[model samples]
Target: MRAGRLRGTLGSADRPASALGFRRVLAVFGALVLLVGAIAAFALTDQVWLGVLLGAAFVAACVNVYWVSRRLQHERPNR
Candidate 1:
């Protein structure tokens, strides 16, 4: 064992590609969930306005998540 060194194995490393892939997967899953939720809400409650509001919220959330992930991916690395 030594300072700044792992005792048994390499700890971790940056993997922007993996992070991007994960985001893509998440985005797809979230879109599917949004679709299902909207359909269920409509069928169960007959509330068109509620469905519209939820859809708008989902889009906003997706946009924010995408922007933040892109910003993080392009961020300057510490020297």
Candidate 2:
């Protein structure tokens, strides 16, 4: 009976795909943000202040990627 209960619980705990899916989504979002930032920087190459804004956006996107990577790593269990 105890073995059956354990098996039932383990079966319900099978959510590896959900975690990976979230990470994949975050990665794609971050890439999109970085791409937008790069395009903005190129478009505003003549304006110093706009360049600063684009640089800030690029930095923010990099920080977001780092944060998401940490979250994904934390969610994954060591083998």
Highest TM-score scorer: 2
In model 2, the number of clashes is 0
Residue pairs in candidate 2 whose N, alpha carbon or C atoms collide under 3 angstroms: none
Off by over 4 Å in 2: 1-13, 19-44
**Which residue pairs show backbone clashes in model 1?**
none
Instruction: Give the TM-score (vs. native) of candidate 1.
Output: 0.49
How far out, in Å, is residue 74 in model 1?
Answer: 11
What's the distance in Å from true for residue 44, model 1? 1.3
lDDT of 1 by residue, 6-64 (tens): 33322235222336546656776786788778778888998899899778867876885
Residue 17 alpha-carbon offset, candidate 1, angstroms? 3.3
**CA lDDT, every prediction?**
0.65, 0.63
